[model samples]
Target: MALFSGNQKNTAQNVYTNMRTYLAQKDGAVHVVLINSFSQLANQVFKCDEKYTTEIDYVLNCMQREGYEILDIKFNSIPNQGMTGNRTGFNTLITYR
Candidate 1:
């Protein structure tokens, strides 16, 4: 699971780089499960930096640029916990040749 928090741009770049290297050595599909919490309360609770959150479009574009086909994209709303409310989550399935 890829938890998108902190410095999102840097995190995405790092993840892309790692994935590129790994895919070069393997021959199979890659499924990336990305979870992003946009709730400020949740961010504070989880100690996630709120300055920037992962943008789904950016991530998708990055992978597509590397020739990875997006097989499926799914979204599930995370139920609000006691103190934290309004958090959203996304589940993506990516396949690479």
Candidate 2:
């Protein structure tokens, strides 16, 4: 993946930026998913993946309870051995609505 030169921080920034724009500019339900692709920082001390996933869940659930629709749910898994570590060759897709 030579084409990739970014880190979790960059990915997070991009996600928030895009999401903010999407929510502000559009008036509809938003489908979100966080694949195992960013397993790079999955094991960090703060467990950022878990935190983000939790936030997504809270928001989605709240929205759903309020009569909004959530097409997808964020995941909560530790597919990576370590945050700064690297691994590949495995594809995990867990779906929920």
Candidate 3:
């Protein structure tokens, strides 16, 4: 189970800023589950069935640019639908030095 706290916008900046705070509480590799539960980070911030892939991807990219290494990513792919049929993509782990 993952926990996300924030009512901020769905912008990468907002998400990234919040992520920094979340990461600050951790020491070493961190386990984060960016699934449907964190949909506010997506472009469709309301009345949409889109996953947080884009938003999460944005954060992931931010992490990479900051010299963070991706330890693992465990997500399910449903054909040509990334977040349409079954919204489930909770498979990513990040490690930073």
Q: Which candidate is the best by TM-score?
A: 1
Error of 3 at 74 (Å): 2.8
**Could you give me the TM-score of model 2 versus the true structure?**
0.29
Candidate 1: misplaced stretches above 4 Å? 1-32, 39-54, 81-83, 91-97
Q: Candidate 1 on 1-97: residue-level lDDT in tens?
A: 2354545667666766655654442346555544343433444365543423354555668767866667777665455543445554434444444
lDDT accuracy of residue 58 in candidate 2: 45
Sort the candidates on lDDT, descending order. Answer: 1, 3, 2
Per-candidate TM equals: 0.45, 0.29, 0.43
Candidate 1 achieves a global lDDT of 0.52
Question: What lDDT tens digits, residue by residue, belong to model 2 across residues 1-97?
Answer: 2122334345645554554443422246344434344343324354334434443444445445645455544344444344444522222232223
- Structure candidate 2, residue pairs in collision: none
Evaluation by lDDT, superior candidate among 1 and 2: 1
Better of 1 and 2 by TM-score: 1
Q: Which has the better TM-score: candidate 2, or candidate 3?
A: 3
lDDT of 3 at 53: 45
Q: Give the number of the best model, judged by lDDT.
A: 1
Give candidate 3 misplaced runs (Cα > 4 Å): 1-10, 24-51, 75-97
Error of 2 at 66 (Å): 6.4
Predicted candidate 3 versus true structure: per-residue lDDT over 1-97, tens digit per residue:
1133222225656758766765643356555534333333343335543335455667778777876666766654333224453333343444443
